[model samples]
Target chain A: MGSPAGTGTGTGLINGMMGRNNIFWHECAVGRGDRQRLLKQKGCVVWITGLSGSGKSTLACTLDHELHSRGKLTYVLDGDNLRHGLNRDLGFSAHDRTENIRRVGEVAKLFADAGLICIASLISPYRRDRDSCRAILPDASFIEVFLNMPLEVCESRDPKGLYKLARAGKIKGFTGIDDPYEPPLNCEIEIKQEEGACPSPSAMAGQVVSYLEEKGFLED
Target chain B: MGSPAGTGTGTGLINGMMGRNNIFWHECAVGRGDRQRLLKQKGCVVWITGLSGSGKSTLACTLDHELHSRGKLTYVLDGDNLRHGLNRDLGFSAHDRTENIRRVGEVAKLFADAGLICIASLISPYRRDRDSCRAILPDASFIEVFLNMPLEVCESRDPKGLYKLARAGKIKGFTGIDDPYEPPLNCEIEIKQEEGACPSPSAMAGQVVSYLEEKGFLED
Candidate 1:
């Protein structure tokens, strides 16, 4: 949601990026703590996994809106949009998909290192792939938000008509059809899109923001 | 250098990244303009190229200091450190080197897109490689700063003793030794190491910030 705004001290930024170059490798410099101090908030990755039409993007965007309104610094790494640029070289094959998540995970870590909340929304389908992302981040820096929705409901939404294509046998290895969607076994947060639990995207966003606030991730 | 501080309008940020999901591909969403306005400054890539020991990193760090003091947003992408992570799969071979620059260019573009002043300091030995980086960016967004330090001077200032290693044949295909270094034919700015032209790192950074200001790249 919202990005926290501040006029950080020189000491803080220097600590954050001093080693970005090789020349200063020998010198002690300011660090992540300074960046966090300057930004008036901590940095973390919010990873959302769901089916194609599970409203993950909408929820991510709405959360970003909520966070920004609260003065939090945030950026969304939508897996789909990343394919248009950073991961453009990757294909949908299983190996390529793993590389895709790997790269996104690394980039998100870089963003967090620089003191920004990175929201990464991906179908992610496999347990091992998600675990790989979790392994690289700092402790408590990764929050998994699992959107649990029935395949039929997601198919009904069919936001991009992808499910229809998959149904027509036009796209093989589709996540919910031929490809399997491995639900998270122990996610940090879980939200159901079923009858009493699911809410509008904005409401769901509020729920996530509440979790962040409750966890003190939003603390100055 | 200084990154501009801001609390941008939700409307603007929403425009810059709303459809990160595949669902909203039919329409444009949040964009660069929103980011620029929020940061209160234009974003551009400052590509610094020179021999390994030509004070490129020093210049970048001092410039970052100057910019941050002035409250401008900036980040430096040093080549050596990138090899430790993002480009870990790459090697010293010519093909890998080219891929390395290509990936850095892509990353710089993404940073600019997010409205951060990106300072990329790399040996980047070839003009064709630099030009390819320029080709991907928007007009006026790529500011090439050629550090015209002579090979002898760079060799004398071997900050990491890498020059000594190259001279002893401990390293192979190094720029300015066995490998060729095609100097830029028409860079936007050129800072020479000669007595009258090259100032202290801080002063040199002043020269750059002045250029940015004169060109209105620093306009609010």
Candidate 2:
């Protein structure tokens, strides 16, 4: 908290005036260099995109846990939880969805700048929006992991009853229902849940870790 | 991820739902209850509040590192970095300030629910807002630590040039300048930054860890 008495009518103004002069000379003394030095590793944003019930959130959370267990700094931005706060104002409309991804992308950039790997899980559904997020991050800093699943499979596993609601017309503009889901043409990693028995969430996360290790993101 | 194809779409939704039911149920059946088990410890939020020029961020980062270095799990919510995303829309107004702390409290509660120690460092000025946050959390869950530094001292060491801007009227509603800062009424721990003496950031953070240990938050 703060000192309430410091805000006396005249004293507040005087302190305000004095603070300006003090600030002018204080900038050169402190820097983020020391903080970066302590961080020791480059940061990145691994964006996991997929349809509802496609295991994107699970994979992101698992990856975050794995990285944390290994002493690597990491964080996860799950779509549903994000809507509860940061992107709360946004809706499920295409425009709102784009803005949501844009905002998440910008935040991920800051997290990476602070030297923490940021994992974002969302049903981006639009290739253009995903590309825009990629543009915001540095080259190779944006790792897109596409959870490629058939629409039928996604609906079958409607973990949140979203697919059913969309089918009932209760949820309009649902991706893979009334709306479209443009798959990532060239993602850094693609999880083919159908090709084999879908890999465990940890296994999918391990693929991400492998990519980070190959890209020199993880310290050996 | 998810299955590639094969499953009824609309009418036979009930049958298709079986696949998802099995997947999640199986996961619950086999998943380790590690996180759930950890919540049995003394629950609380180690609220780290201080001036931006002070070492709140550094201490938070170090404390998180130390806690994780041990077997204890922790999640840090930093002020500057969080503003880049979750609180991007909010400005530094008295009202917005309260709302910011409110949102953080909700998130910290979620982290605590998931059995992780939550460390939040913000220059939260209002005692009412902080007290409100503490109210929502369980009894003894609020460990308020005040980073007590003289305004002149903090201004002299303005790390972000924010104090300078506030003085020049370049930034409106700056804490300790245009607005007021209400120091904690009875904080659990207070770090005083003196003219010729001060504990290192790590040492200061160690005091917090020791308190948590004494309170039985950390394992022996």
Candidate 3:
């Protein structure tokens, strides 16, 4: 018995179902070039990592404000705000931390794809997780900024008393406490919070704007 | 015995221990009026809810484009895009659905509190969930727009083949199929998707702009 006309064996059936079987044909009809042209701007993710109380969220919000003021589309996904929603179910366990960073990385990638600069401020202390995020994004699109405040500095400036609690053994597995913090091996930018000489968040934010401009992501 | 200096059981002791209770003072300093004056605009969340392929996203995006073109600060929290990042782990189950809307609602509230018009597009089918969002936000801040498309019309469009899959039993617990979709009890605006003469998404978007202007949200 012969096979049905539309259901030929193996290769013939595949060809019959797809008709022309030219997967590349649709490339000409749909192009990313139009989206790029419409946006007239490059999109990227600025991943800001630091210890709690190291001014990561402050810097991220300031950068967002500055970028928005300059007519650039920008969004800041902060650690506290994100935890209150997206990462609410996640606990402080090491595995959950990895998952949290993984999820944020994916979301940041989507925002970048949608032609918006996404600023993510998280205390993502694991270098492996950070590396995984960099792997997912395009080269030059993942800007890793390390807020390299000394442990003592962060502890002294414990705005939320988290460091104090960690020290008192109330909070376990806190980064810079019982757990480890693998600082970025080669961060794009590093900000040091000097005692009584720390630059305002706006000043740090200005550095980010300059970086974006130098990288040709923003118009002069 | 009397308590030690700066450790008395009165207002002085309380103020001394909490460092003058900066939280309450900061709350007063950063009141809603202050935020509005600082951002130079009032904040609100314009929530657009409807079934899949019911023009909610189209209308929200159009409104975002229009508001953006006019130099207003706005951002869209689209359902699909958000799921890809912020709410990626959430399934389409009822519990996950509630959590998704709750997260979106909290994020929108934060964005609005920061003095930006937050536009959220979701297939928020449950009236209770929508009501919870309204309760979380301030009065006059939650402007709900219902994309009131009949189920048959939405099914006929089948822009994403979701309705068809639901009907074929390929999809489980689909809203409007095996599940229920409760329309908004008293929505601020309703966009009727009439047969053969549906309003363009841009026109529908313009209606929202008109409402914002009439309500003194946008300068004429």
Candidate 4:
């Protein structure tokens, strides 16, 4: 194991010293600023959280379209959609659900770090998990949009027939049914779809975009 | 549970009654191609893999600088740098190492999917693990650039002193020391840094950029 040729510190090609932290860590690389400069827009995570069938994915898609049409780079990290791919290994168990959100948050942070607006649409029923996501992002980069629709409205608008299964006891621990949904206490935007008439997904998306514009996020 | 008002299905506010498989999964959202079109470039993962101190991160950073100068959207996902943040929970155990590469693979795939040329530099050590990464990307998007430097050469160039620790048995399962680094047999690009004189990181990065250009990945 004692190879004299390799052990000689002075004979090394790069000839660097050996303190664990003393290694020439190249920290100055292409970062968020470089990407944002190239793309001509700031990156952030627009976390859209709501109950099942509360139009989270639809609203994310609508917002993505609005941003893309305006020459802004964006990506949507949809919950159900990711379950078909990256989060396929995760299940509905509490531990698995937490892990699922952690992975999603990490991925969303990476996308934002790469200077692309990331619209993360998940039924992140827990406030702690959402807060953890917010904690990972840069300041003023985590926009939480609570789809403030009533559970009754979401049940009525169950697009995936998931509420039916949950109601029939076929799907256990369904959020807002058998499980509790903790809404965000201090989210930036709140779309009250249950106020009177349900707003179209586009209108809700426009509202969110308007919020971003008002906050100067949509500007250069 | 048997709420007639919610069970009627026609009483939905969104008014979109979807069969279990009929919820037209909004697949036509802003996709990779759309982002590519807007950016005037294609997206791919330029995976630079080798033993520790083989200049993998340096090459990645150099390539990123080159691409950024050329107005290409690029991001570098270095191994040690990420271990401090994203993969902080992981360790150097064989299983943890494999899991580490797996997560990095998934993140790189997401980047490529977002229509950005992602430079992933990691001492991934295992052929099967790396092959798994290649499988996740779309066709011709996984550019595996094997930094073909000898173990002795890498040891001499020990930038992180990780090699020194591994040699002294302070660290276990270090690639090319106590562990194995399976060299690529059929890699897309192999830069022989061991042959004759070792090329500068920028020169090696130029080789990679040239290969990407040859493959039409750097094209509009």
Per TM-score, the best of the predicted structures is: 4
Worst 10 residues of 3 chain B by lDDT: B20-29
lDDT of 2 at A123: 85
TM-score of 4: 0.87
What's model 1's lDDT at B192?
A: 86
Clashing pairs in 3: none
Ranked by DockQ, top first: 4, 1, 2, 3
Candidate number with the higher lDDT (3 or 4): 4
CA RMSD, predictions in order: 7.6, 9.7, 10.1, 8.2
Q: Write the per-residue lDDT of candidate 1 for residues A46-151, one digit (tens) a residue.
A: 9999898887888887887777767666777877666655676777778888888887887777667656677888999999999988987888889999998888
State the lDDT of candidate 3 residue by residue for A93-136, as single tens digits: 66777877886786676556545677888888989999999987
lDDT string for model 4 (A164-191, tens) is 9788877678889989999899999998
Tens digits of per-residue lDDT for model 3, B162-220: 67767887767778888888999899989895665678978899999998888877631
Can you tell me the CAPRI class of model 2? incorrect
Write one digit per residue (lDDT tens) for candidate 2, span B13-50. Answer: 22233321211110111111233343234435788887
Q: Which is superior by DockQ, 2 or 4?
A: 4
Model 4, A150: alpha-carbon shift in Å? Answer: 1.2
Native contacts recovered, in order, as a fraction for each? 0.03, 0.02, 0.06, 0.30
DockQ of 1: 0.15
**lDDT by residue for model 2 (A117-144), tens:** 7788888889998898897676698999
Task: After the best TM-score superposition of candidate 2, give how far the Cα of residue B133 lies from its true spot, in angstroms.
Answer: 4.6
